[model samples]
Target chain A: MKYLEDIGSYFLMLRRTFSGFTKADVLRELIFKEINDLVMSSLGIVSFIGFFVGGVITLQTALNLTDPIIPKELIAYATRQSIILEFAPTFISIIMAGKVGSFITSSIGSMRVTEQIDALEVMGINSLNYLVFPKVIALLTYPFLIAIAMFLGIFGGLIAGVYGGFISLDEFIRGLQEDFIPFHLVYAFVKTYVFAFILATVPAWHGYYMKGGALEVGKASTKSFVWTSVLIILANYIITQLLLS
Target chain B: MIEVENLKMRFGSEEILKGISTVFEQGKTNLIIGQSGSGKSVMLKCLIGLLKPEAGIISYHNKPTQEMNLNQQRMLREEIGMLFQGGALFDSMTIEENIMFPLRMFSNQSRSEMLLRVNEVLSRVNLDGVNTKFPAEISGGMQKRVSIARAIVNNPKYLFCDEPNSGLDPKTATVIDNLIQRITHENNITTIVVTHDMNSVMEIGERINFLKNGLLVWNGTQEDIFKTKNEDVTDFVYSSNLFKKIRDVQNS
Candidate 1:
């Protein structure tokens, strides 16, 4: 009975957090800056990882497609699918989980343990609305920035292929243009939204329920990163199957 | 004014608060005093909605807390200011920012107006020139003062201090106690303080509630406390040699 009640309260709190996300003032003040930072601040690391992975996947896919049964155009197709649907959203959210998710959890968890949340509540401020909503809203919107990173990553692959003399710029461009599908892009963007939600919610929930002193705040931060990363990967695969099949 | 009626709180099998009840009148410093494990803090938490009680109701005025919705509960909470035991100021923010936090969160005050209010509260707590200093640069007593400034910045109707003097030196503790008393009187707010310190009980115990094993054992004014015949209350109060000597000298 107690466990059921706890679950019920958790859902209620989650609903409260979501409703808070819908407020225009909160979005304007808090979430906008967070989205800008999550997208802009992480650009360097995402670009660095994106370029290297893009090069490797391109090399491997090109070498395998040398068989007469497979068309050389298939390499570009596979790269497009991987970069948009998987690499852009999943890997970027994983990196974000390390950076932004950990920050939210630690800050909120410490506030919880230290009675800052209590202070807010006593002041008639909705602690959940004030603390959690902006974060969720920012995270929900930040993935569009990662979609841009996907373009850059694929561009890096084309550059690497041209530099290595595996494929000419004109050939790569032609392959990409011919292989692109509108539905794939839509599917990829939708996947990013889900990844962002998992990344934001898991960490926020962990931080919200935190108890004890500084040690517990540390624990919540570490757990937020670990669980968010795991959930992102698992979610990526499930979404892939659901979308494709 | 606040009234807790037959409040019971439990953590699993451990009953941290058992059938505790008391009233804290407005415009006075009301104290809840007990040993460390005697459930004083738990009762405070229960009153403030940090912890939910398994039984009984806490009322602000005559409105039962259990009857209020989340927003109404939040409204009641907003009418409160709390000085945490650890002086839990936000580390990333400076003293000015820390003091300005509640005003920013709960009030529609503009930046300049918020700064003016922050300065006023900081001056009230004697933290005039150190507005930009981080919490690390301040002493424990100063941190408590900053916490006090933050608490009062919103001009709350109820002020809760959880061990407001816990780690301060004697002089600092007195400063915090005096500050709380002064703030209570000035604002005419119902202030409830939870502590184990006899100094606090004597200094600001306009009304004191004694809790023994999670029960309200006695409630009275400081003068009434000195005249009480209850052994438990006397044993708790006169346990210190300084208090014992004072009691002996007074009797003589």
Candidate 2:
């Protein structure tokens, strides 16, 4: 019953947040700041994780192909499939469920604790639209992040495969092109956009409706991370089943 | 002026405000005083339209608040300025940005015009050259003054303050009380301040409503408060040795 209530409240909050925006000029500035905080700052960690994890997946696939008939090209194919289909979209988002998710929760949750939100309401400002909408717009750049992750992940796999003598550069490149489905890119980014909305709204719901003090802000951050990750993973499964099957 | 008629509010299982009806007069520093948990804050929230009451009529200039649509309510709120108990300054913003926030959100003033207005209110609050500083960089007293500056920067027709003097030294608290009184008189705005501090009552309480357990037990001026025979008001007013001695001296 409580979970159902939370879900209902979450939709209501979304309606208010997206209904009518306030002060477009000021909101433009806020959107830029959010882009810097939420998207730009995340680039470094995402790149590093994407690159290294791609290499690790390549190495694991190479070692597993002990049968002689299984072409070395199978390695490049497998690594490409893993990174594009799963790692870039799903894995990186779960990472951000901790990084960006907690950030959204704590910043807004701290505002709730100090009565800043109440101050906004008393001033006739739509606190949800003013605070959360900018984040939602800023995260429209999220698909860009996954695009970079997709490239870096495949590139890292190439480096690892050729350097480790698992496959020649030509063979690996050919393997990457072998039976490559054009729609997989579409499927991956579709999941990213959905995950992006989930990332912005869920943590904000926890922060905006949260009740308590500083300790509760911390608790809300933890809850946001858990719930955001759960929702993202669930969304990943749902999107894949619909788009692929 | 603001009027409340039979205002009532409740949480899940408990009522916080029990049919409170009172008038906060225009151009006066009206105060609601009560013990903690006596619904002082609840009453203030209700008056500001932050918390909708279960049963009551809140009227501004004879317009019932419950009848106002969202746009109408927002227009009403635009005329209001509030000073929260904690100052509620935006942590990420500088004092200048914080004060200019309402202007930027609701007005078409150029940045230069807004900056000039911000400086004017800062001077009114006796804060000079602190615009570049953040909330965390200032003292609690300065922060409260900045809050006052923000509240009045737009020249609101109504002002509400929740515990304006809490978490301050007595001397600083007195300064805040005087500042609020001066601003109230200068703008002739309807102002409601909620506090339990006796000093605030004595310093600037032009109209006082004394509540005990969500009920208005007494209503009078500061002078009338000292002379009232109501037991609840008497017990609350004279609970301190200093006020008790002052009352005894008055009697003699």
For each model in turn, which proportion of the native inter-chain contacts is also found? 0.61, 1.00
Scoring the B chain of model 2 against the true B chain gives a TM-score of 0.98
- Compared with the true structure, all predictions reach lDDT values of 0.83, 0.94
Candidate 1 per-residue C-alpha lDDT over B1-252 given as tens digits, one digit per residue, 9 for 90 to 100: 898888998889998788877789999999999877889998988888877899998999999999999778866776789889988887767999888877766678789999999999989988889999999899999999999999999899999999999988999899999999999999999999999999999799999999888888899999998899988899999999999999889889
Tens digits of lDDT, candidate 1, A1-245: 96577568767878888663323554477677666655567677777888888877788888867777665666666776778777877877888799878887888898888777776665566678777777677777676578767887788778767787777777777777875778877777887888777777777787888778899899989988998898888987887788877
Worst 10 residues of 2 chain A by lDDT: A18-27
Pairs with backbone N, CA or C atoms under 3 Å apart (clashes), candidate 2: none
Per-residue error (Å), model 1, residue A193? 0.5
Q: How far is B197's C-alpha from truth in model 1 (Å)?
A: 1.1
What lDDT is reached at residue A13 by model 2? 99
Where is the poorest 10-residue window by lDDT in model 1 chain A?
A18-27
DockQ of each: 0.41, 0.93
- For model 2, the superposed segments whose C-alpha errors exceed 4 Å read B250-252
* Residue range with the least summed lDDT across 10 consecutive positions in model 1 chain B: B70-79
